[model samples]
Target: MGLFTAIRDVLSGFKSLLIGMRITGREAAKPILTVQYPRETLKMPARFRGHIQLILDPETGKPRCTACTLCEKACPSECIDLDGLRREGDKKKSVSKYMLDFTKCSLCGSCVEVCPSDAIEFSKQYNVVSLGREQFAQMDLYAKVEAEAQAWAAAHPTPPAPPTPATPQPAVTPAASIAPKAS
Candidate 1:
């Protein structure tokens, strides 16, 4: 009885090994699906959420953010902080300092959605690497894009100035004109 049992166990183990090898052989015959990461990069999907950045106005070549604080208020993680100053002739307050604490940010898109001017959008920068935590702690969004904005502004023509009102002509009275005719 013991000899029969040992033979049965050996046969079962052999069968399992053969099954595993068969599966491995079949898989090995298929084409390789591994990506050579360094040589070949995969395109990120359109909906991939990355860090948020301020959108520059094409016409003005300036950040669209009005420094309204709506985005700051809307941020759930409290990662956004910014201020603005109303220039002497400007109607809306321009962004003076826009800071983003990326460490605290959850990339929730609240800031982008609450912005009234469509000022902010998700950046396509997927590969974010830093040596220290402080490196990503306080990212100045305004300063980062300042040079690009300046270059854009320099390249583009300024908007046409508003048409000035013409000088008013002297009012002519009907009686004064008739007297002048001297019939």
Candidate 2:
């Protein structure tokens, strides 16, 4: 009975080894899914959310944020801090400084949804890395976007200036009429 039991234990161990080898073989035969990062980057899916960035208005070349504070209120993590100033001639307050503390962000999309002007959107930047936490603690979204806009403006040629219309001169009255009428 001891001999038979020992043989059975050996058979069980062999079976387990075979199963492991089979799985390994199958996996080894499959295509390599490893992306050689730095040399090759994987395209992020459309819905991939990395961080919040202010959207620039194409027409104005400025952030669409009106400094309404709706996004700040909607953020559950309370990572957003911003200020706005209404210029003397401006109708709405323009965002003066927009800061994002990414350390506490939950990526809940609450801020993006609550924004009435669609001023904010999730950034596609997925490779964010840093040596210290402080680098990401206070990201100035307003200044970053502003710098990008300036760089783009420098790269692209400005549109041609609209032609100024010629001013019309008043017609001269007849000399006879200009003189006092004989009475």
Candidate 3:
């Protein structure tokens, strides 16, 4: 009786293995779930977070970013960095250095969600192949900003000189205050 039971258990295990193999074989023949590179790429949604891309103000052509640094705070990876340009008054600061180390990015999209000025976003560009470490930390994001700063300065002329203030006038005492009231 024990020998017969052992034989039956072996047969049942083989049967179960065959069933699993059949399902795997069927799945392999079905349509693939991955996108083809350099060919049939899937269209990404408006907010499909991928590579980190700068958020630009369409009107200013510049960063449109007010250097609020909200995106930096939200970044989990801390790959994004921004330098606030120095300004005297109303003029905006030029970006001294705007960098995003792509290697460290986690593709979490936390930075994009917190951007108040819509100055941080993700791009559809997936091919970021790099050989060296420096290449991985590409500084591609700053090029557009540099050109915009130049163009903004050229198009928007400087304001005219601030008008001088007039000379001070003596304070005149009214007659009612100087003369005593009559009985």
Candidate 4:
């Protein structure tokens, strides 16, 4: 009876090992999903989130941020540091400096949602790599937005209006002066 029990245990172990080997064999026969990295890049979907950037106004060709501080307040990690300058005789504050600390940022997208002017959006920079800690500290998001606006303006320039032809006009004769009657 003891010899028969030992034989059954050995057979069960062999069966489990065979099942594992079978799974490994099946997986090895399939195509590899690993990317070659530098040579081959993966296409990210539209909903993929990366870094944060400022949204620019199409008409003005500038950032739509009014420096309302709504986004700064909404950031849970306190990674957003925003600054604004109120020019002389200006009613509203204009964003002068906008910094984003990616080190502490959790990519929560909270800042983008609370923006009233719709000034914040995610950038499609998926390959951001930093070797040093200081490199990931803060990024000048405002400058990047400004550069984008300038580039867009350069690419799509408004055509100048055609000059109108100058035409000679006849002058109207003055009416004869009449004496005013006493009421």
- Top-scoring candidate (TM-score): 2
TM-score of each: 0.74, 0.80, 0.55, 0.73
lDDT tens readout by residue for model 3, 46-145: 7666777675566555676666677777888888787776666647654556678878988898887887667767777655566788965755676756
Among all candidates shown, the one with the greatest lDDT: 2
In candidate 3, the residue pairs with backbone N, CA or C atoms under 3 Å apart (3 or more residues apart, or in different chains) clash, namely none
Model 2, position 182: C-alpha lDDT score:
72
State residue 39's C-alpha deviation in candidate 3, in Å: 3.5
Residue 82 error for model 4, in Å? 1.2
Residue 179 in model 2: lDDT:
89
The TM-score that candidate 1 achieves is 0.74
lDDT of candidate 2 over 1-183, digit per residue (tens): 999999999999999999999999999999999999989999999999999999878876767899999999988899999999997887889898999999999999999999999999999999999999997999999999889778767777689999998898999888887888678
Return the candidate ranking by lDDT, descending. Answer: 2, 1, 4, 3
TM-score quality measure for candidate 4: 0.73
Clashing pairs in 1: none
**Per-residue CA lDDT of candidate 1, range 1-183, in tens?**
999999999999999999999999999999999879889877888998889988889878888889999999999999999999998888999898999999999998989888999999998888888999997899999997677798997898787999998998997778866665546
lDDT of each: 0.90, 0.92, 0.75, 0.89
lDDT of 3: 0.75
RMSD of each: 7.3, 6.0, 12.4, 8.0
Model 3, residue 142: C-alpha shift (Å): 1.7
TM-score order, best first, reads: 2, 1, 4, 3
